[model samples]
Target: MLTSTFGAPLAQKSARAKEITKCIAVFMAKDMRPFSVVENEGFRLLINTLEPKYHIPSRQYFSQTEIPALYKQTKEKVIQTLRQANSIAITTDGWTSRATESFITITAHVITDEWEMLSFVLQTRPLYEAHTGVHIAEILRSAVAEWELERAACGIGVVTDNARNMDVAVREAGLAPHVKCFAHTLNLASQAGLSVPRVHRLLGRVRRVVAFFHRSTTAAAVLTSNQKAMELPQHKLIFDVVTRWNSSLDMLERYLKHQSAVAATLLSPYVRRNAREIDTLDHADINDAEDIVKLLKPMKMATTVLSDEKTPTVSLIVPLKHMIESSMAPNEEDSATVSAMKRAILDNLSNRYTDVYDWLLECTALDPRFRTLPHLEEDLRQDVFRRLREKAVQLSNKTNVTMEEADEGDGGEGTSGPTPAAEQPVNLTGTAEEAEVEQPPPNKKTALEDLLGGTFTEPAVAESQVYCIESEMAKYKNGKPISLKSCPLEWWKENAKIMYPLLSPLAKAYLSIPATSVPSERVFSTAGDIVNVQRSQLLADNVDMLIFLKKNM
Candidate 1:
């Protein structure tokens, strides 16, 4: 093949396309005032060699025209992707920016025919009305309609924080089955655990100590030097954010890790001048900090496991809830404040999540890995199993025996291919010409089921009911729970269709429920970066466009 030149002649782009391109580039760069940047002598000089003939658009063009056009295009694509889903779950949360503007993020979760998981950030619209249950529900309904999911065959559910307003909103929107974010619940428990007065005082002192080191380069330098001399790792001091639940754990862990270095640094003349008596960590302070960190590690893991979107988290909800609650009882070796914290956590989990276990039991009961119905209270166990079987049969919507299709000219089974012997044939096929134009045979069950095994040759009701009974009965076999590391979705995707056909739909439905609304909360973290001091003047509409493109594109 002949070699082509490094660059080739190209047609000039339309002003609108060029404008959209520049605004997206600038928006993604987290920059404000595109015109100023484009007009800069250095910026112009750098881009000159790459595109000598092109000119950058004015800020007015980007703000007024390009952002709106780009948003419209991206939104259409998001809707198209959403329209293909058999079911949809949503995760939403609200945030306030440094600009003091309130915004809500909504993301849709869907599972494809091949058992692949996908998500789309549907909207990051500003919240103009009061952020109440009714208002949030209204916005959610609009988002649902925009994606045409209001009339969607498979239903929609929302995962959100356990905040009262959010709890009220999903119910008001008629999207409830009590699917609060497990990760957020864990955080709240952690929060309550730390609320004991002494522990609270300890955390306050820790933050102050960290704050002193955080803003002081001299203090950090002295600490690092001491760490080097002591042959310890020179880790940075961790600071806590008010909104981040685990920040205190992180601060304490880091402080304890460099405990000796910090002690040495505080004695240095520069630190002595700045640090107060309260900033110093005594032996008791160190012990309390260690206890807090030890208690929080498992919770952090629980948060991480639930917040994950790549794997199934819904199945882990009940099991992890049990794990978290069992860990809440304090050992006798624990200090008085630490004991109080554990009891508080225990109380919080019991009160806040009394109904959650029942909701999650339905999910766990359907999972093949953790078929531990015994995990549920004895009174509720059988009911959960009954609900599982009922749910599967209902969702399958395959209650009646299927009418057999005519195979031969006499509507006969004489030309038997693979039809099961149990269901005798009944001719449903019409005239040859009409049959030719018909949609694919309704003999096939589910798309996922077909992937595991072919169309059902047996009568539908007998087969579905058998699978339903088998699924409920499977729970009593060997009461051990699966490893936390196991992926229940993969187990079902690989085997459930063949083993428990009726329960497959239930498996897919509950497995697809999102464990956390962190996807929406994560959008706000990105929003914080996008709307910083440098780009403080970014308009609300354009900010929405930039965020949409950043995520969707």
Candidate 2:
């Protein structure tokens, strides 16, 4: 009767109603909101006020229907996008939910033909079996098979954290060309330095001082008042997490910023009466904290840079290690304690990623920015170049077969399948609305120079490809590298086809491999949010759908 008076309400299957429901699912995935939010009185009220003719669905409708539908649709699109990639790299990691459910996340990194780096969260499957290497390998193989990427690109490049099981799993899975997460390695090295007895003791005392502010309201209030009185930024104390050495640096740095306020808070009469139980940092502790912060600042910066997913990082491993080594070197003015800390960090940092040294060196050499490989001796650089020549020959063999087939055509003179549309070179102006501009052309070789130094063009046959690759290598090496802040991928995008066709695809293969498993770790971070207390009852499959949508959609 009410519907008759107000006009028939929207059906659940109506376009308007289904659209709203899909949005609700998207809200849950994007904000990590619980599906039960639909059951909340205020939320229902808001919905009712917004659309009197529409009906809100139950949480079950979203969890069972809308989310799964969205997941399937999005996965299809991701798969199609993956097909367009010339090469890809894989990163995977494991996590345990609050409900004691174990999940493993897999992610793929690829560079678009236009050179835009894209990362896909492929899956976050719940693990029902043991966490043994063999079991893990099976799961990995299944993920690759499910994605239909078993033979895609230049073979799978797997990256995982520096865990024993991860190492065994990659080997067991036969996913060769694996890389240990460089960020994890840096953390281990940084922790080794922080574990020095002198630094460790100093940090503990400082931790207690920060804890006092957190525990005692009176102390915290006094610190705030002192900060205003002393004209310092209104910043709170930072409590360091044991696992993240960077957090320790953050705590010490924040404390140093408000050292005067903290000292005044400690001396406050209200604080002192309560301070008998608290241990405060002394002058020596303060000095040590300052020195340690100085030591760790570079490590913190390296972690920040390498953890970024927007840019290619595999090529950065060599250069960053060089920079870290230089920073960890002892100086004449160093205190005995600081000197010891330096030794500890260098000791742990040295010989890391040794298993992949040759691979890393190859990536470094191919990167135009670091082609000179200033960090290595001349002989080491020469050895890397030698490998590059061999790799060029191996790649040329593969290229020859494809070219021959293309020449033969599908039936007569044309290749099968529609030719792919050409991608517009990246906009130097950083906007499509702006007038189209030409990619600034590279320096041209003079006729005499071309004759003497060989033209930078594609080889006509397999036999000449090796000689052409050598000529391209010489030109690349002699050419001035772009600025340190410039993007190597962007440079290649602009010049790859015209200047170095043989090496361009090789760059695509190597540069797509990330230096860390941060992409997979990032998925688990989203998973943690999705599988929280309110949603603890969510089935593993549901959790996977939510996390996959949260990341991909």
Candidate 3:
């Protein structure tokens, strides 16, 4: 009877009731999980479920502005936590996007004396138009001050790559002595030292040949079938020069074992094309191939040498020097070949090994102040020479031993002597007048000398003055524990105010704590991680929030 009178209204009411039931069920499901554990997941799910209600008629429920307000509230809390840290270090680095807009990210972290890393803040901003040192410094200072750490003594270090602008900015900001990233330096040195251009070009040719064979399905199948005919199976292979060199050497040695199959494979139509290209290669290419083969031949010997568990008794330099001496020795027959090999080795060393030796010498000659504290200067020097001698020995051992053994053994057990100390030879041509340099006066006290003071004062000159003060102070031994009540506080304070006017700036400088660049470096690394390509769309406010959250959490 009720439905007959108000059936349309009842249907509308029933639909609304179902909607309410669904909302209640979703809310209850979300509430059952720990709030912190499921906040993000639950929020996303709720947003998806409420899609229709957002535009539904006769409903004015949730506000869109509330979500943003909640985010703001959380961000503020994060900022407060960062501000509470005692000290923070910062890092900053510049990044560019595909669109070519440059951005700078600054990161802050709190450090403890025990070297605990606590992430503090990370912020990204559009690199300012000027991008000058001053401008960069201002940006960094603003970011640090934002966290209320502008005056905090907790900023112990800054770390950065060797960029002049970034380094200058760090110094201008009064964050001195920044540590250049050691790992980056090592990588750069290794890349420069080990990347042989000739080797690279040879490897490139190998890659091209491999690509030609592998690109076509027919060529790959032919190569595979041929490999199988030779009692070998084709496998996925890379055109690594080192790997290929070893493989080629092994195959060449076993040529008699598989000569028929090898001949067939090489004469194949696909192989013919590769061989034709190889045959037409220039003399330089042939030399490169020979050189590569020769260089790699020593690898087997090198591996054998490395496998020996015992450290070689002889130093590296001695063996290498001995090898050079032996190779250069006069021979009745094969003299030309010996001479050519010796010259090639010498030329290679002069070009490649000179810099390494120079660097070692420079490192060894560094001031005693820079030497490792526990090791004495003599010990440090010995250690360096020992390493060099060992490497030399290994190189010398690589040469043919039988022919040169008699010649080398002539010098007896001590055949190869220690490398002579590298000296700065004086120019004998210079006049005596030119050699005589001016010297400072002996009485002129250096900063350190002044700080140390005289060994003993002349007693006659200042004795009376010291005795008068001591004698007067000795009378002040009242039974009441030297109470100030027995004497005027002003008189006592005035008498104690003796000034040391002779103190030097160096002495004053020593009183301050040693500053390091580690803090700046860490900040730069953190900044790089946060403002990377994947997160480029982050807005300024969100970036700030993320930085604050990272620093605190």
Candidate 4:
């Protein structure tokens, strides 16, 4: 009767309704709500006060029965999603809690055959074993083995910070050369710039002023009163976090926003007792802070773009690195501190990111915006394209698609089925290629082809109206490049198999890596939030299940 009148079912006893309640339990876990809320006395009283007839399962039933079943089903789905990918990249990091408990998190990134990007939290379990390189490698191998991706056919890349421990661990795991987190590297370089004597002195005074207002109630009240007297917006000072310098940027920016109020607060007798001589930030000091913001703001935006989990970031690495270097140049009239900071940043960039562009050369080349590689020297530019074309041709030898098959328009030339239309058009603005380089020597082969054994048959180059991978690449290089505004993965969806069937897989592989282990670090932050003081007694197994379901769902 209720369903007929209201156009929605009201009965909670139906099978589908029960399933939904179980899903609600998982959602609560994802949001970090207390499980006992489902059946606590206060909760029951609140619900009874509103709708006494409505029903919900007891906390014991949901916690002990429904959640386990939900986790099992979700685990199977996560595994199935992983199985559909041809390659996977991994990032892992260790975190410590206030109680000194150690936890490790592992995250995976992959691009589906249809060119959809995905990232999932594979595991976030306690570390009972020692922190040796061997133990780290063992945990890494177990996670990879669970997804059944141990072979060269499922090539894996491991990304982490430049910490010596992680470096030792990657070598022990025997994966490819380590891919350092691009965002983390930028932070390190930014920190170097901020460490210059003049910049450091400027930020030091700002930090002291913020600390006074943050800690003393009298100081905070005086600032509030002063802002009101001036008819200014009410706001609190921001303090830079000691561990992360990015917070320092926020602190400096916020201090500038309310500089008038802060200066007025210093005049208030209530705050004067706590204020030090260093607390007197002058116009010269304020000018230095403004200069620092101009230098750091672009770096901040770059970090955000590279830290994204929903988009392909590896392709943006080379281009962003170049963009940052070109953006931080100090003008002749700039302050001495600003110029010194600029040189430190540039030096750090040269020393650290030289390794980055080399590793990501192909990814940059594949991105339509960077197809010509404007930043590289002429000789190195030619060599990058040469190796890329070689990899494309070798990948083509392993596929069954030919130009004629693709031309027939069956739509299964390189994949198992047809792709749905993309949400955005692939930009076809101008050719991505600069000029064609000589073909790779016939002796060349990809690491996967070498590991998995040679291709089944070697066809003679260009026979019987069949398409060759080299020819496809040559044709593609001449086609118009896309706008930088377009999504790189969407462009691949439109043109990967459609325009260059044999080379699409190689392109997807290059774009699958996350630019930083920031995703992995962010996973640790989630785990930290889940395991706070009140929930300290939660078992490791339960924590793992909750984190996995939360991320994978």
Best by lDDT: 2
Estimate candidate 1's RMSD in Å.
9.9
Using all chains and alpha carbons, the TM-scores for the candidates as numbered come to: 0.79, 0.88, 0.38, 0.81
For each candidate, the alpha-carbon lDDT, in order, equals: 0.69, 0.80, 0.39, 0.72
Pairs that collide, model 1: none
In the range 1-553, model 4's lDDT, one tens digit per residue, is 6446445643787776576577668766778755666767876677555544446777767767777787888888877787677567888888876557788889888889778888888887678888777788888877876755443232467888878777778778766536888888898889998999988888888888888888889878888888898887888999887667688899998889888889888877777866756366777888888988988898899888887776678778778888888876768887887888889998888666454456587777877667777788878877776666666544443222322333444653432332121111111111224222233234446777576544443433434113466676666655577787788788889887767776677777677878899888886677776777756766777677778877877
Better of 1 and 4 by lDDT: 4
In TM-score terms, which candidate is top? 2
In model 2, state the lDDT of residue 135: 84
Ranking by lDDT: 2, 4, 1, 3
Model 1 lDDT vs. the true structure?
Answer: 0.69
- Candidate 4 local lDDT, residue 163: 80
Give per-residue CA lDDT, model 3, range 53-134, as digits (tens): 3212121121122223334555576556555443344556666544355667665544222223344335667674867778
Candidate 1's displacement at residue 53, Å, is 2.9
- Candidate 1 lDDT over 451-490, as tens digits, reads 6444454456457566656654564334465665776667
Model 2 lDDT tens row, 240-356 = 999999999999999999998988888888889888766667787778888999988988998999988878899989889888988988899888779999999999989897878
User: What is the Cα-based lDDT of residue 362 in candidate 1?
Assistant: 72
Per-candidate clash tally: 0, 0, 31, 3
lDDT of 2 at 454: 41
